[model samples]
Target: MFARRRPCRRPSPDLRCRPSGRATFAAFAVAVTLLPSLAQAQCGGSFSGFVRGLKDEALAAGYGAATVNSFFNGAAQDPKVLKADRAQGVFQKPFVEFSRRLISNDRIQRGARKSQELNKVFHRIETTYGIDRGVLLAFWAFETDYGAFQGDFNTRNALLTLAHDCRRPDLFRPQVFSALELYARGGFDPARTTGAWAGEIGMVQMLPGDILENGVDADGDGKVSLKTSAPDALMSAAKMLSHLGWQPNQPWLQEVTIPADLDLEETGLLHRKSVADWQADGVRAKSGSFALRKGPAALILPQGHKGPAFIAYPNFDVYFEWNQSFTYVLTAAYFATRLEGASVYDAGRPDAGLSGGEMKQLQKKLQARGHDVGKVDGILGAKTRLAVQKEQARLGLPADAWPTPALLKRL
Candidate 1:
C-alpha cells in the first residue's frame, strides 16, 4: 500500500523544475557551431559514441575544454543505474503502508528529538523563510535517513547512464550538464561526488542542476555544501520551496472526512475548490475544525475514496513537484504534521496497490487496449490514472483511479 506525505511550497521560476534543455541551450548552440570540428577529433567508435556525444554536449553547453574532460571521466551508461531506474519500489506500494514506512513511531520520535537539537537553528530559518521546521527535518530523514545514508552512486556516471538511456534523455541530459556546472562553479569533486541513483546528491538528495541553480550558503560559509552542511541543505530546500510557490502561512494538506453521499468522483486535486467550498459541499475536518484560511485548497484521494481524504492547498503542487507520487507527498506532509504534534493518520481502508511487475502488466494491458499511459515503467502517474478511470467507467467499476489486482485481471 502507499501513503501520502508532503513537500509543500513553491520555488522561484528558476527554482522550479529545471528548464527544458534550456539550462545548457547556450552551450548547445556553441557545440552545434563547432559540431563538425568537434566530431572530427576521432572518438573511438561503438560504445564510445554515446560518451563522445555527451562530451560534445558538455562542451557545446559552454563548459571549457578542461571542464568536459574532468567531468565525464569517460562515463558510459551503467547497467546497475539503468536497472535501478526501471524499478522503483516506493511507487508500487499502497498508501497506508507507504506512509507507515516513511513516518513510523521510531521516525516520529527521531524527528521530535531532532527538533529539540536543532530547534534554535530551524526557528531562525523558519523566521527568515517561513517554511516549516518539521517539513525540513522530514525531508532530511526521508532523503538520507537523518544523514545516515546519502546514496553512493557516482553522480556523473549515474547521470551519464540515464542521459544515454532512451527512456528520459530530455530529463537526464539537462541534469548531466547541470552536474558539470556544479563541478565547474559549485565546488563538487567528481572523484567524491556520489548520491541517489538518479544522481541526486547532498543530505536532502537534490539534483545537481537544482543545487547549482538554487543552492544557498545558509551557514554563511561562503560555499554551499549540501552533503556536509545541514544549514546549507535546509536553507537551499527553503529557497526551492519558496520558488515553487509555498505559501508561508498555509498548511499544505489537511485530514478531512468527505461525505459518503457527496459525489466521490469529484474528489481529487484536479477537481479542486477552496477549503471553504469543500466545506460547503460537506467536507469536515477529520481531527478538528479546518483552519487553513490562509490558502485555497483541493481534495486529494491518495488511496481513492475508500481511504482517508484531505484538502490539498496550493502548496500541494510543490509536493507533487518534489516527488510525483501522491503517496510519497502525502507521507511527507503527514510526517511534517507528526513533528508538529499531530497523531498518526487514521486511514480509512486496507487498500493495497499492485506490485511493480503487476503494475507493468497492467500498463501493458492498458496500452494494448489503446490507452495513453505514457511508458510502462510501473510508476502510477496522471496518464495511467486517467486511463484507469476510463477503463473502470467502461467496466462498471468505480472510477477511483486506484489500481488493484482485480482491475488488472479484468483488463
Candidate 2:
C-alpha cells in the first residue's frame, strides 16, 4: 500500500503518492503552434511533442529561452506518476477505519506539541487569517506526516507526465506554467525539487499553482519556503484556506448525537439545515454546546446512521475546496478536533458495507439504471454515494448515503 495524498479543487495543489512503474511512451507529430488552452486537447499524441509544445508556450509567455530551456532540460515523462494517479483505492476505506488508522496517538501528541512549540506562529495565523492552527496541523500530519515523508517523485516530470496524459490534462497543464513561474522567482529547482506524486510541494503538499498564488514569507526570510520552513508552510496553508472562504472562528465539523427517530433522508451535504432547525430535530452535541455555531450545518452520516455522526458547518464546506475525498476531509477535520482537545469519536457499529468488487458491481448497476456515478472504480465517491442514496430512498430504506450489502443485493 502507498501513503495517501490530498486532491484539491480546480488545478490547485494537493498531495499524494503511489507505486512507481514504467509505461511505453507514445509518439506523435510535433506541432508547436497552438496556445496552452488549445494544446491541452492534444496531450495524448506524444510526450516529447507535448513537452516541446509546453516549452514553446512558455517562450511565448515572455520567458527567456535559457530559463525555459533549463526548466525542461532534464524533464522527461514519468509513467510512475500516471500509475499513482489511477491507484487511489486507499480512499475507498470507510471513515471509521480510515480515521482510526490516520489519527494515531503519536500524531495527536506531535500535533499538540507542535501547537505549543509554534504558539506564536499559530497565534499569528489565527489572528491574521482567522484559520485554526489545528486545521492546518491536521493537514500537515496527513499530507506528509508533518513533512516526514513528502514523496520523492521528480516534480518536473510528474507535472509534465500528468499534463501529457489524456485523463486530466486541463487540470495539470496550468500547473506546468505555474511551476515555471516559481522557478523564475528562484524558489523551485526543476531537477532537484521533489514532492508528492501529484507534484505538490512542501509540508502541506501544495501544488505549484497554489504555491505561486498563496505561498507566504511568514518567516520574513523574503522567500516563501514551504518545504523546509514550518512557519512558512503553516502560514501559507492558512492563507490558502482563508482564500478558499474559511469562515473566521466559525465551527467546521462537530461531533453530535441525533435522536434515533430522526429522518435519515435529510442527511448528506445536499440537505443543509440551520443549527436551530437541527436542534429542534433533536440533534444535540455529543459534547460541548450548540451555541458555538449558529449558522447552517449538514448532518453528515458518513458511514450510515449506525456510525459516527457529525454536523458540518459552512467552514466545513470549505474543506472540499482543499481536498475532494469525503473520507479524507472528514478524517482531517476530526483530527483537528482531536488536536483541539476533543475526545475520540464513538464509532458506532455500522452495518457491513459492500466490498470493493461488490461496490464496482453496484456502480455498474447504478450506471445501467441511468444515474451518473462517474467511474466504476470501486471507490464510493460523492456521485456514487448520491446514487446509493437515491436508490435507497426508492427502495424504502434509510437514504443516509451509505451503501450497504443489502443495497447492493437489491440492485
lDDT of 2 by residue, 3-88 (tens): 33334354334221111222100010111223345444558786788899878766665567888899999889888998899988
| lDDT by residue for model 1 (1-411), tens | 111112212111122323343344344534544566532322223546878776766665656777778777656556888788766677667778777867777877888887888777788778877888888888888888887788888888887777667665555655665676666664677777888888788888887766766788878879998889887888888877776677785677778787766665566666666677788888898887786754467777776777867777777777766777766777888788778866666688835768888989999999999999987878777778778777877897767778788899888
Each model's lDDT: 0.72, 0.82
Cα lDDT for residue 84, model 2? 93
TM-score of 2: 0.91
lDDT value, residue 2 of candidate 2: 36
By summed lDDT, which 10 consecutive residues of candidate 1 come out lowest? 1-10
Please name the candidate that would achieve the greatest TM-score relative to the true structure.
Answer: 2
TM-score of 1: 0.84
For candidate 2, give the lDDT of residue 194.
94
Residue pairs clashing, model 2 = 5-15, 5-16, 6-15, 13-207
Per-candidate total of colliding backbone pairs: 35, 4
